[model samples]
Target: MKLIKLDAIDSTNDFLKGLSVTQELENFTVVSAENQTKGRGQMGAVWNTEASKNLIMSVFVKDFVLNPNGIYQLNIATALAIIQVLKTFNIKDLSIKWPNDIMSANFKLGGILIENTFKSGGRISSVIGIGLNVNQTNFDNLPKASSMAVVADTVFDKEKILVLIVERLKANLALINTNSQGLWNEYLSILFKKGVPMPFKVKEKSFMGIITSVSAAGKLVVSLEDNSFVEFEVKEVQMLY
Candidate 1:
């Protein structure tokens, strides 16, 4: 595992994308930045962060066997890795939101963005980027955002945090290679709002349901008040805030 640290970059994922084509990048190569100028999130959203206040890094993995049904496991594995690391910091009330947002009591603590490059046959590479709020104290514009400092009541050293995350990610990646189902089950155990009643929006209609389980294919299974279950793809439904 080689780490490339930079003072700033447009986006760690973007930087890796550019390099993926020209270079023979190895698996577990990390690209980290002190600041990201144009960070990206799921569905083309911008990932906003204060410079040096968060852990912004990307990991490159190549030669993964792509099971169309198991693609979502990558997100679960990455999210679990982050949560495992945060646990060592003794942060309580931390959990993962579906598809990959780290939350603490409804306030977002971090997020994971996975971008894959495919060749003719299988996955050529995957860039797993993570953004975690660590020391930032204020969240004026972002209402549901929070930092570890707020929850822990103290500051954290960035370098140490990065090291722990890398180690956890490595361990999780190994688990992915061996016991993906176990990893998925463990991920569901820490899911936010799991087994709780909540409102979700689908096709502009709001319905009250309980999150029962997340399918291996990444579809969210929700049980409605009528006891019927519906599975939702990523864009098919939105979790009500």
Candidate 2:
């Protein structure tokens, strides 16, 4: 549970990744920054957060050892951990959007970015970066964004939320290590838009589709109007808001 706190940095993910290259980081080692100048999000988008307000951190999981084919378990575990903590705050309409974005109703409350490193003999280490909107309520420019304070109508202590998330993450990781099958089912149970027809776009074409399930490899499984199920990798399709 070694934690490194920084006043500011470019990206916590990059910082931990750089350290993992030259050093053997312990499991649950965390690097958190008060402000990230170039915070990264999924699909290379920049994550914007007010200074010293949100949770900007990266966690190191050593000796993950899980099969590469089951990497989605990592996403499931991380997302569920965040959802559990948000539930304690009584945040309404909590859901995990595909590939691990925490959402309240339709607004994004947090996101996860996981980077895995493979070593010899099938060992894996994961550097998981998480960005959660905590107390920052202003999102006029970003219509899809919301924070714990905004949705719950109460200000939250960012550090307290960080500690709770890390604790829950460790617990979730332990559960997945033993009962991945059960955890997978729980993830699907709380998945957003599951079995509901939603708008999506693929290559400038829009269509309505129902999300059936996610593949073990983390592909989105969508059932279209033609009753054909299609699996799509991230970036191959976009879930329309």
TM-score of each: 0.95, 0.97
- Predicted candidate 2 versus true structure: per-residue lDDT over 58-117, tens digit per residue: 999966546888777889989999999999999999999998899999999999999888
Report model 1's TM-score to 2 decimal places. 0.95
Q: Compare the candidates by TM-score and give the number of the best one.
A: 2
RMSD values, in order shown: 1.4, 1.0
Displacement of residue 145 (Cα, Å) in model 2 is: 0.6
Runs off by more than 4 Å, candidate 2: none
Which candidate leads the pack in lDDT?
A: 2
Q: Clash number for every model? A: 0, 0
Which digits, one per residue and each the tens of the lDDT, describe model 1 over residues 110-199? 988998777787665689999999998889989899999998998999878887887877777777668887888898898899899988
CA lDDT, every model vs. true structure: 0.85, 0.90
- TM-score, candidate number 2: 0.97
